[model samples]
Target chain A: MFKIFDHTADIGIEAFGETLEEAFEETARGMFAIITDGSKIEKKEKRKIEIPFEGDEEILLVDWLSELIYIHDVETLVFGDFDVKINDVLTAYAYGEKYDRNKHKYGVEIKAVTYHMLEIKRNKKGVTIKVLFDI
Target chain B: MWNGPLIKIDEYRYKIPESYKGKGNNLKMRVPAIIYASEEMLPSIKKDDAPEQTANVATLPGIIEKSMAMPDIHWGYGFPIGGVAATDAEEGVISPGGVGFDINCGVRLVRTNLSIEDLDRKKIKELVDELFRNVPSGVGSKAKVRLNMSQLEDVLHMGAKWAIENGYGWEEDLEYLEENGCMEIADASHVSEKAKERGKSQVGSLGAGNHFLEIQKVAEVFDKDSAKVYGIKEGQIVVMIHTGSRGCGHQICTDHLRVLENAVKKYNISLPDRQLACAPVKSREGENYFKAMACAANFAWANRQMIVHWVRQSFENVLKMSAEEIGMHIVYDVCHNIAKLEEHEVNGKKMMMYVHRKGATRSFGKSRKEIPSKYRNVGQPVLIPGDMGTESYLLRGTDEAEETFGSTCHGAGRVMSRAEAKRRWRGQEIARNLERKGIYAHAASWSVMAEENPDAYKDVSQVVNSAHGAGLSLKVARMIPLGVVKG
Candidate 1:
């Protein structure tokens, strides 16, 4: 599950899941939802993204979202769902379609993911993380 | 309320003494934190974390004199918007947060000989509509001018000079630009391939958010001499373009920030917030970020210059007049978000410092030789734009601004969140109200219109008054928008 929070000049996201991978996926979904309605984005295309990590989960999270932003900009894709796997390297399979202004309802443009108040933690129930975006 | 210890220095100045440090687990600060705001503006400013952000800035290493926030301060990521801090060039640090994501996000004003009496409401509406078509705006707006890899690299290095070389603007336009529209330190080699890819097609686009192209009329002149020097007369028409480097700058900042995040650990720099990640000024990471940042700044200068050309074309198309006949010439351009190596007197000794102005303008007084020869006797032109339906001001820098490293307010700071503004006002209602007031607004969507309601911002007139009263900048003229095209 994921939820959006209000920031005075930007936006924030809080995602929770049964595992870190699930949390990452939820966060990705939440970020896309902020850009446009996720329900409207069809999973007609799939792209794979891999990011190498050195055990810093916080930086890894930022990289994950940044990759998605780059893909969105270059390929004009609006992702609706994400399947992520975490290990020494994290891999994500993003599913969505090209953004069509007439079909996609536009929201605030997310410029980049920020480290402001960025966090990732695990407890008995699940893992939860919060992130802020510069818009 | 801030809940922090604040000392009233004067009616327009407040200080959080260096002894105050911070609340709870915050670090000790090297300098005091000063904020320029009148008592009337304090309540709105205190409602957010801007004051805390300003105080946190004081904790940065080698911060000289004081960490300061202008009268238009607002809560922003890492550094508070409208914040200014200068650090020792040899021993201090450099942070991307100090410059914000939109590198060199600035404003440019152009004056025309045409007066309001010469334009009818129908002609004004047609001109605005033409501009809306000419300028690519809104979210993900692509540019009509696409550059190849080599041409894109040229833009990163040459800035507005490249635009003029390509017939995008007049040769004399470069004189009125800050830094001649190109910082010498810009190295395209340091900018990433991804940044170039994003920039190639975004050179002439007016990116979304507060970015806009507006037609305004000089409504009032406070200083006849200064206004005359700026070539702005009451009731004369003028154009203002507000934008930055677009996605390219955003990507560059993002890429460098990751490197700096690791650099912080390598350099063992401690900070109260992770968003304040930085590296020593002389470090490899720091220099690389500066180089890439300079490239982005150049890109922004070129971007605005291209838009100026388009605006000129739009006016000519609608009015059937030549550029010379229209008397459209640049008044001045100023960067609001940037970090530059500048010389200033610190402790009575002239020294070079890395002055970081996140959402502040460089308000150099008359003594500075960097200003154009045309207005050297007066000072740098400080352009402060208001919201879509409010009044903007043109001010001249003052020698007193040397106390704050020659910086002043950027715009009418936001008092409400986009969500809050959207909740409070409907887009249609806001548009209707602006239309009723004779201001034609062409926004991409109603939500954008509502999110940028003039009421959602602090009164710009009051903000300018506070800055003028504090002697940071002196008022020259006031402008009210006749039409606005927002992204």
Candidate 2:
């Protein structure tokens, strides 16, 4: 599950899950929450993106968010929902829309996903993570 | 974190209360952390969360005086951008965070005889193209001139001297470089084989993002005497080289971070930030890191030297002038991220301390023996680069800088995050926009261009103004970018 906060420019997503995969989905949702007002972006624009990491699970999470950020920058698309599966690596099929400058009131721009404040823990309940975006 | 009130020392200076001191923070800090900034710059400093970083640095073992922040302060990994702190030599700890990922990421100025009158759109474009071609750039970019293990060791030890010996630049250029473009204490033996492997082929490359080569013209002369001393004249053309040791430096930092991280536990050193992991200066770990870091610093100086050599060659080829006729010479080379062992007066006694300047420049004022004889009277030339579209500044160290441990702001600090700048700006449009302003833009990637857009940084004029007001560096000559090459 994920809770979204109204940050000035970027949406802040707080996610909790019983597994790393669930927490990652919430993180993706957080990124989308800031891209478009939840009310504006319907789950209409859907696409599949499966990202493979060269390193471990922690770096995989960063790479996953970095991929979405890259897609946002290169394709000019915004996603609202995320369904991610972590089997050895992360594979995600997400939903979003083409960024309409006229319609989307841009929030804070996150430059690069930093390792600062990045944590993924394997607790008794499951895995918990907190990542901050540099806006 | 300190829970006490922030005591205002002056309009530009403030202190964190003693009540904020945390356990495991040693060194008997003489005063609370101090930061220099105008009213407007303070908000960005706070918003960037650099103040807490400053407080965190104060918690380092053997920290002395006060943890300080410059006017251009912003959030960096372990230390705040423009953070400066010194620790007792025999006991103080050295952190890789104090240096940064881009070890020896610095700026160098190349003075030229050609003026604005000699450069038009076509000529400038031709020059930029030549520079981009001759100078290898971009991320994961390989060097055109490869070096084997032996050659790499020479570079690690000899630094810019190796470049000069290999016919990269003239001997006279060495005089203008910090430590003569080579730090003498550098020990390649201390550097790991993996770091050497990474550095072997990466010399003379510009690498990527924020690293650039810009063709600029002298736009304004603030201190004519200092400008003249620096061989900069009004309207003269110049090439500004901004880069570091590239992969070598990055790998060096990475390698050291691991060593220091483990050292933290081995040495039983307590630090507030994991990124600020360190070991005592006299300890085996500290000496090892210093020696290796010096090698990295040397490699960085050599990297810039090779780039400068190519820049000279590019000018000669494009302008159809011999190197002599082009009259290109190095004005200065200065380092921003490093920690060096030096002796400074503390409590009426001279004490050896390890000065860690993360995003700060060593601005030793006049009379220091380390300064070149030519600049000994006016102090060392401090190069401060603005963004591509805005103006860069040339400054001289002020006497007050010596009081602050020979430190000064490095550049116009980033104001907007890269993502924000990209969202508001189109890379192609920004490139075209520079063209309209009579400036040229050549970048390896759109992301790089957008990240380095002039708007992403604060107004350089204000940054310089604050530096002057803070008594760090005196403005000399301002440079305007004519043609820009970004990686």
How close is every model to the real structure, measured as TM-score? 0.98, 0.82
Docking class of 1: medium
**Per-residue lDDT over B85-154 for candidate 1, one digit per residue giving the tens place of the 0 to 100 score:** 9999999999999999999999999999999998988999999999999999887788989899999999
Q: Which 10-residue window in model 2 chain B sums to the lowest lDDT?
A: B22-31
lDDT of 1 by residue, A10-78 (tens): 778899999999999999999998777777999999999999988889989999999998888767789
Clashing pairs in 2: A9-A107, A9-A108, A10-A108, A111-B419, B2-B20, B209-B487
The DockQ scores of all candidates, in the order shown, are 0.65, 0.07
Error of 1 at B55 (Å): 1.5
The DockQ of predicted model 2 stands at: 0.07
Cα TM-score of candidate 1: 0.98
Superpose all Cα atoms of candidate 2 onto the true structure and report the RMSD in Å to 1 decimal: 7.2
Cα lDDT of model 2 by residue, B1-487, tens digit:
2233456777667777545654344433344688877777766666656777787888788888788998888877778888999988876788888888678889999888888998888999999999999998764456788799999999999999999999999989899998898888888888877677668777998876667899999988988888888888899999999988765676567667666767888988765666787888888878888898999999999999999989989988988998778888888999988888877778789888888888788887886788899998899999998888889999999778866788888988876765566678878888989999999988876656776788888787877788888888888888999999987
Among all candidates shown, the one with the greatest TM-score: 1
